[model samples]
Target chain A: MGMMKHLMVRSRRRSLWMMHFCLGGCNGCSIEIMAALTPMYDLERFGILNTGNPKHTDVLLVGGSVNHRNRRTLKNLIDQIPAPRLIVAVGTCALTGGIFNEAYNIIGGANRVVDVDVYVPGCPPKPEAVIDGILSGLDKFEQ
Target chain B: MTVSVIPVGPQHPVFLEPFQLKLVVEDEVVSEALPRFGYVHRGLEALVVSKDFRQMTRVAERICGICSAIHGMTYCRAIEKLLGITPPPRAQMLRLVWSELHRMHSHLLWLGLFAEAMGFESLFMQIFRIRETVMDILEQTTGNRVIISVNVIGGVRRDLDAEGADGIRRALKKVAGDLERIRPVLVDDYSVRKRTEEKGILAKERAYELGAVGPVLRASGISQDIRRTGYGAYGELDFEPVVESGGDCQARCKVRYRELFQSMDLIRSGLDRLSDGEIQTKSKEKPEGEILVRSEQPRGEVVYYIRADGSKHLQRLRIRTPTFANMAALMDLLPGLDLADVPLVTLSLDPCIACTER
Candidate 1:
């Protein structure tokens, strides 16, 4: 147990709190994130709770694309989350700015501001894909 | 009392998308609210310079995923107007059905959010459970759930056969039955009324003068519905605007709740009127003039203005989304509201930031 605490990482893996920051693309992905949390898909069954405050979050689910206006807000959100910060970039826009990449205000995807652990690709990924993407991001805790 | 400025914005538990509202509060009561935009602004209107007119359909649909079908239909209707061609009757009927289905799902989604806004977690899940039925219908019939790419310039890309239409009918009936069981909790439940009634009252005259649209306008006793303009397949269908005169948060809730059934009725009637014909008309000529096309989206009226020069691309494309029209009304209603009431009032406007900022 050198520098990394295996017990704490294992504890965080059991109950992951996700805070979704919609960074200014069409909110299709944000809606899918909610759809994933609700009954039919029920991401909560995996001990995941959708949170609002960055302070309470373990895994940050970033939706849409990164834009000039929201970049500062995105950085502010990332700064608020404590250590062991894991981010899953959901949707094509957040991955590489997708269709809106050519637009004037878009600054590209989430990685432009902060390092994203996992990138889920879709115009707006299905709820299952979002759930899968978040689960896969848990593997990053190994480091 | 000293006033405090609280910014509820680009990311909040209550909001679905990104946008900011600066509340000027004295005590816990809000005195003024200043809105901030550009959080998710992608300059979508400017994309016409890069994307061709024929390709703008995908761009238009992306404006707001909740109302994607109607946005695409409005863009196609505007293009159809410019090209001097009308979509086939069957295409129009299918468009109406999809549009109505979008309305149902959108309302269900909103109702669930409204319940969540009130902290009614169980009700939220219950409504979303019912909403899943509508989503399945959309996916099975149109081949995708949320952003179903069905509309084209001349007509719709998909066709609904007798089997598909029958499945839709059965699904809608189940939705109605589910809704009926859930109705009492939303309608007569004491807590729902306590949180909603008289919370945000926009008088009839104020709503009209401030340019409120959709359920917000109808909730204030105005019986105006753009469907009466006979766009899409509405001309062949018989329906009346669902109006409520309470002019409060509860009134807006009731308006949308009633509309869920109204949309089911509209879809049923459109299915009855579905005739055998081609979905699209062949038009080789490019559009060459200015035209304005309007349609009733789930949120409200969406207007698409297109100017073409007989070339492959358009000269200009402008959209006036309903949320834009409702902003002034929201500003007017927000002052003198309690901090706790802000979420309910804002949700009453059905603020679609993607549509507004785009």
Candidate 2:
């Protein structure tokens, strides 16, 4: 337990690599997230970076509305990310499917697949808001 | 050796949307590639038939978050055309401003993702940092970040005054300057070039044959921009589509990179030509005809087909997103590339699976 705590703290400071999964979303949140990584927002100063491989990630930032087709994939990805992992549900779609909530195809939001640690609500959350969500997720990892 | 079929998505690290890519790989090279969509199929088209015109704007905006403004704009334009209502000049300019803002942010977001896909961590961070300014400006002006909900049937719901326009212009200038700084990183950086150049080569002939749109088409040396048709305030703006001949991942990157500057210029010009009038015209009559509205979204050309039945609700709404057109290009581009480059190349097209499946 002590070793796990120390490793968590060390990992939290070293790199908070994030892997984003789009279940079924308009790509707004995902785009805003990508915006968060660009030169304008530059989330790297805080050690936040996007990881291509889930195995290398510390957080999973899930975007879009979840649907039947992507539910299993979302679950599989959540399980793949190494533990002590934080899950951030970005955008209103990921939180509650927002405007798509009542749609027949949508399976609600990200929480339907895995446990979400933080929720950033917006049709598509702003880049700054995404940054804040990442920071808060990092804080959770530290705790 | 043995060939293995590895499934990459439906939900994967590299893809944000749910779609399955069946990669038949022999060692590190992909021999066969199959893409399966319909993961997030929300029957959006069917919903359009059920919801009233006002409620459908909400549905249209939900089609793709990155191009929500265009979706809303296109839907409104289609409805407006059907109802025979011309929005005031000021409203047109406002729509242009917001649309260009959406384009600016959308392109920046894709660039960051491209950097991330290429494994260039620092560049990704730098690009996203600059994207924040645009988002902040959007939030302040539109009152919402992702889905601004500013587009109404006849015109627009939001208005920007002189001070607001000036502030947005200043913000655009800053974004333009930031893009300039990042441009070299994407264009001249040796690593970026190494990873992107000659990778995912979509020949010009094939791009056209497959109906690729936006930067993907522009990268293939096609100068087809929906803006050229003079929709919205684009007709009034002085601009040219950015085209590149390379037809590779790098070329696609260049097209988007150049478009960032073009969008900024368009925004500045739109602001300069700002006129004062009512933002929306009163339209109590229901639309009664069919119209096809095309707009250049941040991704590419989006076609909104509306069939109204002289009622408040639309009889039918069909949206063909840029990503849907680009999907055929994806099937062609992925097969001949190394497995490692699959994600990078796929992302270069900026495939919005949600938009495609919706």
Candidate 3:
């Protein structure tokens, strides 16, 4: 178990391929995630690559809120991702479902569906804040 | 050739948001395409009952990040109409400037994504790098990069000083210059043309019938623009809709590229016409009537329907986003196209699923 923890720690700091899932929120957080991937923020410097496939993803970067319709799909995506995966919930919606939390269809935040490793809060968190949240998630894994 | 079903999205790399497209294919050609919505449906319209009309502007802004400014402006416009109040001349001009800036950023973001769809990595990077300048300017002015909540009921919450206005002018100038260099690349470049030309042809009549808004309609040789409705400061500005004849992916790209320059010109003119005045007014009266307000978003025309019952909260708030109107065109455009062209065609419409579903 100790050796497995050390291996997980080493792998966490390396290239982390992220699969982004948008359950149901505004496009604000999704665009901010895109910005983080682009030249200015360049999240690639931290060895974070945005991938489309859930199976290969080390981190699941979820945008938006989990609603009734997408609950099963969200669970499927989380189930698909390999173990020891970190889920970083971006934006206010992902953290606590933001404005739409009280809506009829919504099932609240990302944590409502699956355990969230980190929550980056903002109407749509800035690219810098998103990166900081990811870094902080990395720190959590180190322990 | 036997037909096989190919599913895309609900979560796909090509789509920045979640929505499914089920493509029925024979050989390599898509026979029929079925789009499934409700992926990003957060029931925002229902929130009107919970939150007051004043707070709904911010909620409306979160409908789509790319067109956030216009969403807020349109919501405010609806409220202003119901209250029978017009924002001060300076506030209107400021709205124009910010709206035009938002348009530029949105078009640039689309261009970058379009380039990515075409598999042009360097061009995508260049477009985004240029887009970052606009984001920076938005951040500096509105204090937030993506969802700038500048719009209030009667007027804007934030005011741009002379120095800030100068900064905007400089940024617009730089963006215009950069766009000038990238113009030929978008419109006439061989590889881009090879991929986009005549790929998804929505004829003029068909586009109108499908209710395609904004660049899609303009690209189909229709000069219909909501700006001509003369809402906000657009009435004061003199400009024509950027039109193209082809109605294909190429034409759509041309229309967006041309509109970028047009938005820059609008901003410059807005800045010139911008007068010194109060940014906002205290609203003593609660909204009492129902008003439907329309604004030209970057993707297309967005209609906001607000029903207020002589109270702080609205009885119903319905938003008809551009994507919701344009999705009908996709049903027409998707079939009979190559499987590989799906992303290009889908993205050409600039589907803001968040706005569409919300």
Candidate 4:
């Protein structure tokens, strides 16, 4: 990688800005994602910010499962995010659709639509597990 | 006059769930608001066909992560009624304890979010810091936070021993103390009142006509709490519905604030009533009839309707979540609000769209 490119990748690793998008399942994973941002787990200490705009995000943390209606929004968000970005499928619902996999109008997990770089597994994973998953996804981000 | 129609969600920074609100803005004031759903709809109610009634307990809980225990409890309560089986007294009391605990944590979660909604960022952090105590108590007792999986088909799946009981008491003491420190900022602070009071006011009669439930209705001076029906151990517990007459965002916030203490008291009394007995009463009998059960979740009243025909799977399972009931009231609140206050006022209703669309 070129010098400026290497510096950009290293700085992105230091401060990973994540944008959360809820797909199709319950609010469990979404709450957990918020919990990770709050005081006790303190994702801010790691220099991570939960951003609102897709263009400002370095990582996309998807909650819930993928379904017909929300898949379009998810793809739109993914298209807007700058590359060298990471896509993290948080919670079991986002991984393999958890319990909502077989429901009609449900198209399974986040992988059904986009490639998930990291998978956090739990019916709803703990904030600690969520942090770990996101950091690992940062490790897998390409230059 | 050029009125701009602004789309608020389905994926907005303000909401944790995917729900849309189309607000018609005239001169920076909202003249009309329309909501759209189906983004988070996973067809969970229909999943009762594939997953058996027993398995649907977990599925029911998944409808909303914040109020999962109550969802599972309401589902089990409906099935128990259908089969004509009653959970043991101790089991009922345990459910009351855990559910009350869930209520505390869920209210704290909302309070934190409500604080953030008004741009009180530091207060938001402080509130969530206190919420961790309640979550810890739940984790200590049930071995999980958020969706504890304590409720089951016949009865509760876990019991609180003496150590666990003491731990909860201590933790609740700390939660109460921490909440006390922040109570003034939440209730009496000039900035808080300035931001919340008289914003998005809903009248008592209108709230009733619109079918609002839980804190939203209670804030409008309707003291209708499903717990008043005395389901489970609520019959034995001594408490009153926390009601406020402001009928605005502040009143709704105050109602939930007061309920946090009520929940704490309920938990303490519920522990006092916890006598030694079998936690689970096994039932091999299949549920064969149709029945509906209502339980008060952290948000409001949740109704579970179950129809069965002597089979493992239910014929039909329908859920009427509190957020669904409050939609009309929400639409009613938006017309007079400024565009900036829209998120705050909508959050005051504590709309859990995941549960609604499910």
Candidate 5:
């Protein structure tokens, strides 16, 4: 168990490869996440990078509000990512379908499909907030 | 042997929004492709019929995360015209400032995504880094990074005092400098050029024939920009549309790059010309009549049609976003390309599926 914890910390520090999945939320959260990766916020300093493949990712950042059409796809993506992986629900829409909460098409929030590890709340959270959520996930992984 | 059809997205890694692409492939070469949207549709237009004008601003901005400002601005302009109340000069200037800022950020965001699609991770990171400065300016002036909730019926809601203006100027200069350094990496880099140049070629004649707008059209050598119509304070500014002749992926990339510099210049000019005045004009009376308003969003041109019935609510609001216009060009460009090139080619149009689906 002690060895496993140390390995988690090392992996968290060296590479926090994130895979972003859009459920049904607006593209706002996704853009903000992109902003965080870009120069000004530069989340790369913490070794957080967006990975294209789910199998290689250590964290999953789910944006948008989930809907009926994407439920199965979201589950498949979650299954592809290995265990001990953290799932972050970014933006108010991902948390509770946001303003679209009342819409007939929405499947509520990201949590409805997966057990989210962290919730970063905003109409679309600022880039800084997105970075903070990733860092907080690192803390959880370390424990 | 029969060809197998593989479905990509509605939830796929390459696409950021919900849209399905059904590709019938024969040994990894796409023979037929079909796209379907509306997976995330919320019937926003139907909802707008019931909401008051003020309430609809929130809905309009929600059309797409990247082009929120232009959507809200277009919606407000349509209502303002119906009421026969022009926003104060300062308000117009502020709107232009925010609009261009949004443009810079949006283009940079797309550039980063294009780079990522091409597997150039470093370039993607670099472009995004430059985008952050614009976001900082946005947050400082408008008090929100994304939604910006600044547009009201008559004008903007926030006021940028002299100090705020000076700060914005400095931010713009810094961002412009960063963009200048990164320009070579985007345009002249061997790998980037090879991947983008000559790929997704949409000839000038074809682009015009299909009615493509924004950088996609401008890349094909057409010197058309909605801003040229002088809709905001753009008429007061000295600017020219950035045009490229290639009409390929590289040409489109160049158009966005040049526009980034132009946006910086526009912001500087707007700040210099900004004057003190009422940021918003009060209009309690119902707006009556129909007016069409068009504004250039970061992606391309956005058109809003608003009809007022002398009530707090607009009778009808129709929006035609840039992505909607570019979709035709996308379908035209997609065929005859290698399967590996699909993501890069699709992104060349800078699609905002949220805007398209909305």
Candidate 6:
């Protein structure tokens, strides 16, 4: 697939860590994704590294809203995160379940389970819009 | 020699939310502890039967975004006392100066996540740079910055002129001079009192028989304060409920570092009694009965039980979160501890798992 998309954009521009999850929002997008790592939206300047280990993540971020007892634990944390991962999905309750989008034990956002790749809507999105939705999910590993 | 268990959280990175403790250890201590709440239960009080009572104060300020403006001012003081309405002393000194600037930006975002769970990375970047000057004076007076939808039911949707009360008295005098230079590293730092002195104790008659509220029942000495039940404008200010007799975890981090200078002296006496009338008062009628609205949140006493039913939906919207009564005193301070002090005594009971599973 085009030389495996330039080696996944040279290994996600050489360092992307990030692993926050939350599902079922209101920690204000996990404290604005831990205030985009303090010192004013530092996001580790760009090397990004908020990890909590989804097997040493590559980008999952996610915030909340995907109920039903955490939708199979958010699909077993997006199937153990390894495959050229990247989910992003920041605030406004993980993108769509903003005001608990008709809270019948929600299932509104975090793309109903996985395949997000970058959303970052606000209701609770500023850590400079979750570091611009993680630098636009680092330009989707250059498509 | 045996017993294992561990488990920490539903997604743990020393938790921001998504609870589940488990623990049980043996060699490294912890004898038992089990906490598990519905991961962010989004059934927001059953959406009070499809949102009403003025859209349930934005679903009671999204239940928990660090006490979203005191859960929309305790659900507009229980629908302004079930619509008796009286809020115009300049919107009760602008909701007591934005609920003491959301209790000094939720106690400097819980002292920068309890100094980054006691690792103390530069006192967690100087308590988040003095909590970004109380989130930039709550985003230049409630335009939005972590859900500051200035409470509205009878009064207060937003109004704090005079240059937003001199930008909240120059941002609470630069967050009370950077919380007085981190109050001697959160009180005589010998590495934050060797990881929160006497760890998780919680005694004072078991923090009032385990019904702990706010500052973990005033750090277990219990002077009791739902702002001494004065409700809005906290009976014209001059407050006092910051007690501590060492119910441990460094007397709940010295009663949230002396209530962050007593919420900057109750927002400098609600900005010297800021006056000049009306902020919003036109609720004709719709709310009917049952009420129970208590406040004092910054992890404590947040009750809000409304029953209203004269019209626009709200038959029952109970809330009760001060981390669900401090999660039964965090299951009585997790057995004994030392599974590496279990994330510093479960983050010294500042557990707001989306306001205790919403």
Tell me, by DockQ, which candidate is best.
4
- The sequence of per-residue lDDT tens digits that candidate 6 reaches over residues B152-219 is 88888877788878888888888788788888888897878988898888888887887888887788
Q: Residue A38, candidate 5: how far off, in angstroms? A: 3.4
Q: Write model 3 residue lDDT over A1-143, tens digit each, in one string.
A: 99998887887887689878887988888888888889999988999998889998988889999988888889988999987688999989999989888787888999998999898999889999999988888775676
lDDT, residue B303, model 6: 82
* Candidate 4 lDDT for residue A35: 83
DockQ of each: 0.80, 0.54, 0.79, 0.82, 0.51, 0.27
Q: Chain B of model 1: TM-score?
A: 0.98
- The segments of candidate 4 whose C-alpha lies over 4 angstroms from its true place after superposition are A1-5
Q: Under CAPRI classification, how is model 5 graded?
A: medium
- Tens digits of per-residue lDDT for model 4, B128-240: 89989998999999998889999998899998899999999999899989988998899999989999999999999999999999999999999999999999999998789
- Candidate 1 regions with alpha-carbon error over 4 angstroms: A1-6
lDDT of 5: 0.84
Mark the 10 consecutive residues where model 5 chain A has the least summed lDDT: A134-143
Per-prediction tally of clashes? 1, 22, 0, 0, 8, 4
Clashing pairs in 4: none
Q: After superposition, how far is residue B60 of candidate 4 from its true place, in Å?
A: 0.7
Residue-wise lDDT of candidate 5 within B90-124, one digit each (tens)? Answer: 99999999988888888888988899899898888
Model 3 chain B worst lDDT window (10 residues): B281-290
Strongest candidate by lDDT: 1
Segments of candidate 3 deviating more than 4 angstroms: A1-8, A140-143
TM-score of each: 0.98, 0.89, 0.97, 0.98, 0.92, 0.34
- Model 5 interface RMSD, one decimal: 2.1
Worst 10-residue stretch by lDDT in candidate 2 chain B?
B9-18
- Lowest-lDDT window of 10 residues in candidate 3 chain A? A134-143
**Model 3 lDDT at residue B323:** 90
Which candidate would rank higher by DockQ, 1 or 5? 1
Q: Which stretches of candidate 6 lie over 4 Å from their true place?
A: A1-18, A21-53, A60-128, A138-140, B5-14, B17-22, B26-65, B68-88, B93-141, B145-157, B160-211, B214-228, B231-295, B301-328, B331-333, B336-358
